[model samples]
Target: MSVVKPLPNYLVQRYRGWKATTYDNNKAWYRHLSNEGQHPRAMIISCCDSRVHVTAIFGADSGEFFIHRNIANLVPPYEPDGGRHGTSAAVEYAVTALKVAHIVVVGHSSCGGVKGCHDMCSGHAPALEEPTSFVGRWMDVLRPGYERVKDIEDEAERVRALEYEAVKTSIDNLMTFPFVKESVESDLLTLHGLWNNIAEGALEQLDPKTGSFVPV
Candidate 1:
């Protein structure tokens, strides 16, 4: 059963509709941006989940945000991987090359990648790294977050804390870059921690004043 053999009906309909208006309506912005390089206002580090749409969440249009999506919205510690760190490269370009003022790390609830990492905390994750088995190694990045919140009173609270912990961890990881650190210190660049709760129709921002997530 190959989906590639026959295109899905809904996808074909969407493609037809979007293709009709996209060129006519979006041409002006595309033409303008072609002459002038992309000057996005913010750099968004977000999840690759289809539901976690960075542009739609902010109601952003073309070139508004330099977006980078990765599994679990995780930012591995800054290290050279022979050539480039894809997410880090975007952060470097957005900070140094593009000079974006804000960089936001967006996380979400019921994320499978996050859930997989959380399950590793329960000692269910295996030690072996078989073919296509990076979950063990990848979840290692979030082991400390589980250690930090293993004592929460409620099951729901425990998950909530893990989700929140993931956000802060990425923020901590973002600061590993000297340019980002200096910008944060000088107020040249601002970092934001956001958790998008699609089910609740709510967006939560980590408020330093209350030291908790509050509705934004």
Candidate 2:
């Protein structure tokens, strides 16, 4: 017998209700999506924070965007070494197989992973520095971003700057992938960096010319 148990009755019931209502409201759209498969124009890499709600922010529908969510929305530098790189794998698939026209890296305010990196790098969260800590290891991707803002005198401004840096860092790393770079050079793919303010409901886009984040 399988070790897994059925989902909690309340959650399952809620899903069933949604499925019924959605099917009744848009049966043909769902069927077409199943038959045609996804052809999303953009691939969005965002944080796994529940409060971010990317679809709602973009007003996107089911087949509009190919989204990948991970801690702090980080993308590690391209490494072709034979290792399990989940984020890299997703990027390769989106670029090579999907041929998406745009790739967006989205960072947000009050990101726990970014905060953890700040704390760990500043010597406040020693546990995150332990070798066996998965968060610590994963957050190594954001250490460079932390370094960029480590010297800021104000704590709040420092963290906010790092959050924006995290988005820029991921965009930089995305270009390290050969396929992504080639696509951009050929004018087939455009890379974008976005930072979202959760509490204020604000968005900022990176200005490539000036290398700064400006309100969107």
- State every prediction's TM-score relative to the real structure: 0.87, 0.96
102, model 1: CA deviation in Å? 0.4
Per-prediction CA RMSD (Å): 3.0, 1.1
- How far out, in Å, is residue 28 in model 1? 1.2
Model 1 per-residue lDDT tens digits across residues 90-169: 88889999999998989898877777777677765554233457766665667788889888878677777888888888
lDDT of 1: 0.82
Q: Write the per-residue lDDT of candidate 2 for residues 57-148, one digit (tens) a residue.
A: 99998899999999999999999999999999999999999999999999999999999999999999999999999999999998998888
What are the lDDT scores of the predictions, listed in order?
Answer: 0.82, 0.94
Q: Identify the candidate with maximal lDDT.
A: 2
For candidate 2, give the lDDT of residue 192: 96
